[model samples]
Target: MNNPAPASPSPASEYGARARAWDWRRALAPTGNVGDAVFRAALFGCALLLLLIVVAMFVEIGSNARLSISRFGLPFLAGREWNPVRGEFGALPFVYGTVVSSLLALALAVPVSLGIAVFLVEQAPRALARLLAFLVELLAAIPSVVYGLWGIFVLAPFLREHVEPPLQKALGWLPFFQGTVTGIGLLTGGVILAIMVTPIVTAVVRDVLAAVPVSQREAALALGATKWETTRVVLANGAPGIAGAIILGLGRAVGETMAVTMVIGNRPEISASLFQPSYTIASVIANEFTEATGDLYLSALVELGLVLFLVTFVVNGAARLLVWSVTRGTSGVARA
Candidate 1:
């Protein structure tokens, strides 16, 4: 009844079981390490490429602007005259227009964008939030030329007929609102720029608000806070991020060309009146770069481009720093 001595496990079977039990980690670790190294190197290369491109752009702009830099010197920035026929150039008006228009855009865009962000992050149902957010972003995808054309045909007339009249009537005493209802000026340019950049500001603010932890909102609510109060608390915490968003949008406004050129009336002068025609750095470049006749004129335009590049660089750099600081703070809070 020793039911035929229990068959001993086969050596082959034992070896097969051992093979089945073997760890893939031991087999694939070297390959994974190689892959990781390759991936890291690829990322570094891409970063290097981006940096090189920026450096190349700076070099190209500097080379082209060299004559103007030598002739005009540092005063080119503060000088107000831009007589192309006499070979004299100054950047102040372009600089002023760029600054004023971008600032106006930011002023007009920030409140509305922030409100939209708040609604999307705090009050909206998921489906509605996504839909609205998508639409908002789609607004940004429209070409600047399209916005410019729309501004010329639609917005400019609308302002002339409806909006600017009231502004002129009510605020005419103010230096900014005193001019005729021409509908194509710094004010109109600002409005177009605002519309163009609002989506960017909104999207950034929405993302910043979303990053606010659920617990922060819950704590705000737990403290007998109203919904608006909770939102305010969250917004206060994210203020630096919002500033960065606005500044980033300002940078976008500063760089806009076609829309501003088409609707800004292309007059290169510093005027307090919002209704007066003005020229921005980008607008000048877009409008006159091809027609630039003399070496100095071309160089001046290139120098204007250089100035614009610097301004955008500074604004965007500051924005990045602000956003970085906010992100670091938020991450620290999350870890804590």
Candidate 2:
């Protein structure tokens, strides 16, 4: 029994095999044209340039700070005294102030930002949302100097006269509320930072919440969830993005200089009370850079800048990762 002649490949199979082979060939091939090669090279160059700039900044600052780093070593981080006269320096107080003020700003801003974002994304009418969003964005564009001026002239007095008095009267037993209510201190600086940070957090959170699939809201409502419950579901789904937004805002508050410098009283001392004056790394650098008379003093200031740079870089990197994760997750859900 002679075997029948093998059947010819079907058209669909032939086409599929050709497509697969083409794909493999394309994958294995070198650059197909000069344009493609040039584009790839340009993109790589841009990325390399950015990396080089960051490395250069780090090296320059480190070299400038070498004297202080050599003299103080690890103790410089925890040293409490920052006496330029005696060539003594410590970063602890500045670090403490930065942490406390930034935390206070986050505390005051996060709730307000969340509320505004939720309302704009879910509850407000289109026209109203547009108007409110524009106003919120406008706040971010206002110069830091302008905010500093407002903090000095308006917010500080208001707090000293009204808010701080009530806070002290109600919570005076707490060390945080026991100091004299100075118009310029950590509290004032925090409030100014809160005002600056709220706009950014709100904008980012509003976008993140809006990006949640509409199907999610519909499903929750289909299950007999109330409006607030539906909103809560959306918020839960977008939690990562919200966290990223908050971290981004914290980074902003951390690097803030002019506004904080103007109102933070510029005192390099650690204190338990928010009403007491304090200094942040940025504030101290701005106040003393030009006035640094000794080499050690200048080197110490450069070291402080390096610290700020590292902190900001790390915070921003974490924020970017969180934001990217949420964005990718949301896209996957939408596609599904």
Stretches > 4 Å off in candidate 1? 1-43, 328-336
- TM-score of structure candidate 1: 0.85
Candidate 2, residue 31: CA error in Å?
5.1
Give the Cα lDDT of each candidate. 0.86, 0.88
Candidate achieving the largest TM-score:
2
Estimate, for each residue in 1-336, the C-alpha lDDT of model 2 and write its tens digit.
267646543556555665564543223323334565567667778999999999999999999999999999988989999899987899999999999999999999999999999999999999999999889989999999999998899999998998999999999999998878888899999999999999999988887888888999999999999999999999999899889889999999999999999899989899999999999999999999999998999999999999999999999888867766666545422110
Question: Backbone clashes per model, in order?
Answer: 0, 0
**Cα shift from native, residue 315, model 2 (Å):** 0.8
lDDT at residue 139 of model 2 (Cα atoms): 91
Q: Quick one: RMSD of model 1?
A: 10.6
lDDT of 1 at 43: 77
Worst 10 residues of 2 by lDDT: 24-33
- Report model 2's TM-score to 2 decimal places: 0.87
Model 2 misplaced stretches (Cα beyond 4 Å): 1-32, 35-40, 329-336
Q: Using Cα atoms with residue i matched to residue i, what is each candidate's TM-score against the true structure? A: 0.85, 0.87
